[model samples]
Target: MADHGNDPVVVIGLGRFGSSLALELARRGTEVLAIDSRPKIVQSMAGRLTHVVTADSTDLEALRQLGVPDFYRAVVAIGTDLEASILTTSLLVELEVDDIWAKAVSREHGRILQRVGAHHVILPEHDMGERVAHLLNGRMFDYMEVDENYALVKTRPPREYIGIPLGESNLRRKYGVTVVCVKGQDEEFTYAGAETVLAYGDVIVIAGKIDQVERFAELP
Candidate 1:
């Protein structure tokens, strides 16, 4: 058995989503056991991941042989095979995997995954669509969804917030958002405090509900 001690992650599937996710995790220096039922797909990902194997994840015996339950995290990235995806997730659940992150094609798919004990369900296309819309609209420099209703927003300080101390801005009170850090052009993010002054080119990272964050970004 490989020493997968550092919270190794198992990824079931070798489709676009699965392959990309496995590659990213592997690149980050995390131990990733990447699996797929297709031989060519497994062969293509051979050296790109920690370990790539060909096996039907829907088979409970196959998963057990691969030690899927031993890993702390598992991601179900099965492509368009919804039945296989759900079955794989179910097998993970039966084996009592600690954290299961499953990708779903739609909201209903996500709900079903959650119903089957997936710790987190992701609608990649829908989530990516929202992110793309936000980026194209130029409403914020960057946006990250924190949950269903909240987000972390990064943007240039509004004109009025410039040359003003963070304490006096009352961002949390007035805008229902909180500025956590600030960074000047070509500078790293620094912790923002009450006396921290905002500058013209300063980028502020704030967290709040999506609607409130949008309101804050609209500040002129």
Candidate 2:
């Protein structure tokens, strides 16, 4: 959970995905307002979100009355109705919301949302499948895209490098990767200027070009 209490977030659907996102954001202490066309869904999620509203998200007038634009970010989570999802997203952009995230059922739907000014579009099922695949592979712990050419990655230490000293490894010269942080169970993480020795079970946070990082992972 990320702290977002100072950031107002609006979730414009109360379906399973929308409601789950709203609850997670609320748990993170964000000021979250959830809306749905279904009164039953709104009623069920009332206790979990900071605020809940029952209204058709496609209605621009209804959205305006709810001060949707005042939110720092908005999520269009209407899954089944493509028209309603597009309309809600468009209305949010027109109101000049700072950021907007849309859920797409397919590649075409994702592209349509992107053209309409959505800051991001998510294909939940596709993303989930990829995540599960990563977990099964067990080589990469997580991946963070830093830019077009670079990424920050978390991975287990290579077997041959498990007992090496940070200063002696010369990972930058050998693999072109820079260790950003080293985490050990017994001590706090060392960032950049770490003078610690690597040990088994320690997670390494490295930043570099994607190819170089992957090369490092391939080391025995």
Candidate 3:
């Protein structure tokens, strides 16, 4: 297990994503260093994180003073500030930060971040819009992206699969997907297995490559 309690995570720009990330890490026993240019934002998070500093992350010297590069992980959660975001990410790379997570405002911004050495770039609006569209279309009950090509999805067991044991369905052999669990209509869950029977109203939790997972979701 990774010891999140020891290695601290540094979060920059205390906007919606940054503040939420810091608080959640702290809540789960991970030490967090939260930084922002805004005094109000830093002050708001005081005592909530291991340390909160009001400093300009884009300034190399300011980041050096905060020991930002010492952290194995750094998050650039700047809000709608493309220049600042890129500058901060560049500094992190220059300092050899291992994992850099950045938020991009647009496709171009994302490309730039990648070029500048951001290990992970997230476009929240674009990703969320696609997620909502999938759920609204009714084919998928819920969706989560594990990576560019992998995903974990929850959808009702295909109508024809209900009342049959998964062992006989040959789902894994046919679709290359695995059912991790089955959510019963009563809201309880059980570990899925070959012998476990699929029931009406059961939400199947399947994980695999996106294409396989979606194909399994459409199972009849």
Task: Give Cα distance to truth, residue 50, candidate 1, Å.
Answer: 3.9
Segments in model 3 whose C-alpha atoms lie over 4 Å from true places: 1-6, 172-177, 208-212, 215-220
* Poorest stretch of ten by lDDT in candidate 3: 1-10
TM-score (all chains, Cα) for each model: 0.92, 0.82, 0.87
In model 1, what are the clashing residue pairs, if there are any? none
Model 1's TM-score against the true structure:
0.92
Regions of candidate 1 where Cα sits further than 4 Å from its true position:
1-5
Best by TM-score: 1
- What's the residue-level lDDT of 71 in candidate 2? 83
Model 1: residue 18 alpha-carbon error in angstroms: 1.1
When sorted by TM-score, best at the front, the candidate numbers are: 1, 3, 2
Poorly placed runs, candidate 2 (over 4 Å): 1-5, 145-149, 192-194
RMSD of each: 2.9, 3.5, 2.5
lDDT of 2: 0.82
lDDT of each: 0.89, 0.82, 0.86
Return whichever of 1 and 2 wins on lDDT: 1
In terms of TM-score, how similar is model 3 to the real structure?
0.87
